[model samples]
Target chain A: EADIYQTPRYLVIGTGKKITLECSQTMGHDKMYWYQQDPGMELHLIHYSYGVNSTEKGDLSSESTVSRIRTEHFPLTLESARPSHTSQYLCASSDLTLGAGYNEQFFGPGTRLTVL
Target chain B: AQSVSQHNHHVILSEAASLELGCNYSYGGTVNLFWYVQYPGQHLQLLLKYFSGDPLVKGIKGFEAEFIKSKFSFNLRKPSVQWSDTAEYFCAVAPSSGTYKYIFGTGTRLKVLA
Candidate 1:
């Protein structure tokens, strides 16, 4: 089973509230990613980390920020949530072992956020 | 810019019917193709992947995909689908070298009727 986990499977908050989504994996994967998916649409990459202390913005511009303080944990935070930010957030992690030949990402049960 | 395309937006099928979903990518270099499935109320999981070696790769739950480099296509197929197979399917591509970023298609939602 994929060990990745995301907290707060569903969240509903008023606009202008600050929130943080937590993601953790027991697989010890070095690469972690955050993706935002709207209903019936493709998932857009928002942020990714190659390893601890290394973070980069993905192709899609996102207002949320992420931190990778440890190999097993990566969390995303929104300074001020808006109705436009209502979407499902997915977290994934992949191993970077040499010659593993497996780039398959293990995903967490996404967090559905609603800003009212 | 590289991009992935899933021609079928939604598909409907009856139980025991054959299934095929089209996927194509626009990139000149070698790539790693993957098929992911998301059951209702579940997280996305890998169905199969083609990194190197054989063009035809089989995945769990009787799922398979063919990688055609000449056409830049990696299509998913199943001989007989079950109602439990109802879910959303996503196709993704990653370059063999450089960054590990993946380009994903819009996705195809399949509903199998019993």
Candidate 2:
């Protein structure tokens, strides 16, 4: 029921290959985030953007990079994929409001990347 | 560093049983608490959040959480859980002082048997 969307629900690529995961939202949200999660595990923040042209690294260290040229588009790219990067990449967006007022996040379907 | 802790790694319950998942955070100043749920084969969804006002805050799907500043805890509770409640739950917190970055816990897996 979320407005966010991610392409290639499942992906499998060999090591050293380049890959890019797509994320977009129609909600025009100002804050976007990229979280890495195992099949049924906790979520680790990898990247986030406050708005267009503003991107910051999250709590977790990631080999991938992201760009936020457009408000609705925030794509993540990996220069060289590794097996360690095999995890579900979840994209989410939320309002920029400070507190309360349904600060809930709307998550996309998620991209399951498998680097073999 | 601000961190969130979920005491239960795995929880099992029968249909119509009550459910409560404990969440605690370590931060000296003001904080923002949140609970997110990820259903089987689905992305994470917000369950509830606490920013200000009353200590107890309600969320979607009959879920609620209480933020006790003195205890520095925000525990998720459901009076009655259904089989559809089987999923992974994560607790996160954002320090009131800094940006909108969040620190999340490892998460708790819940299994509701029909």
Candidate 3:
């Protein structure tokens, strides 16, 4: 089983309320990613971190910001949440072992956010 | 821009029926293919992955996928599916070089009736 964890599996809040989704991994992975997925839709990468203090934006443009101060933790914060930001946020971590060009990612239970 | 495609959006089958889900990618270079399963209210887990050597790779729960380099396809199959196999299946492709990003399909929702 993967040690990746996401807090607030389900969240409901009003528009303009700032929220922070927590994601942590005990595996000490070097690569951590955050994706936004809608119901019955494909997951779109929003943010990713190669290692500590190395953060990059993914294919999808997201209004949220992320910080990777610690290797194990990658938290995403929305300054002013909107209804359009209400989607399932999934956290994933992967370790790039020697000779493995692309490693399989271990996903955490996604945080489903709803904005009213 | 590399992308993954899953033709089947939704599939329904009875117990003990054979299953096949199609997955095609746009990348022509060396790539790693993966199939992930997400059960109801559960996290996405790796069903199987194909790196090299074997064109056919078997995964847990009797799931198998064949990597066709010529066709740029990696399709998932199962001989007999059970009710517990009901879940959403996603196909992802990652190129060996250039970028570390993985492209994922829209996902196929499988429903098996017991």
Determine the C-alpha RMSD for candidate 1 after optimal superposition of all C-alphas. Answer: 1.1
- Which digits, one per residue and each the tens of the lDDT, describe model 2 over residues B1-114? 777889999999999999989998899988878999989877778888888899999999999999888899999999999999999999988776667777789899999999
Cα lDDT tens digits, model 1, B1-114, are: 999999999999999999999999999988889999999989899999998898999999999999998999999999999999999999999887788888889999999999
List the per-model TM-score of the A chain: 0.95, 0.93, 0.96
Scored against the native two-chain complex, candidate 2 gets a DockQ of 0.55
Query: How many steric overlaps does candidate 3 have?
Result: 0
For candidate 3, lDDT tens digit of each residue in A13-113? 99999999999999989999999999778899999999999999999999999999999999999999999998999999997777756779999999999
How are the candidates ranked when ordered by lDDT, highest leading?
1, 3, 2
- CAPRI docking class of candidate 3: high
TM-scores across all candidates? 0.97, 0.93, 0.98
Give the CAPRI class of candidate 1: medium
What lDDT does the true structure give each of the candidates? 0.94, 0.89, 0.93
Worst 10 residues of 2 chain A by lDDT: A96-105
Could you tell me the TM-score of chain B in model 2?
Answer: 0.97
Q: Model 2: residues >4 Å from true position, as ranges?
A: A39-41, A98-102
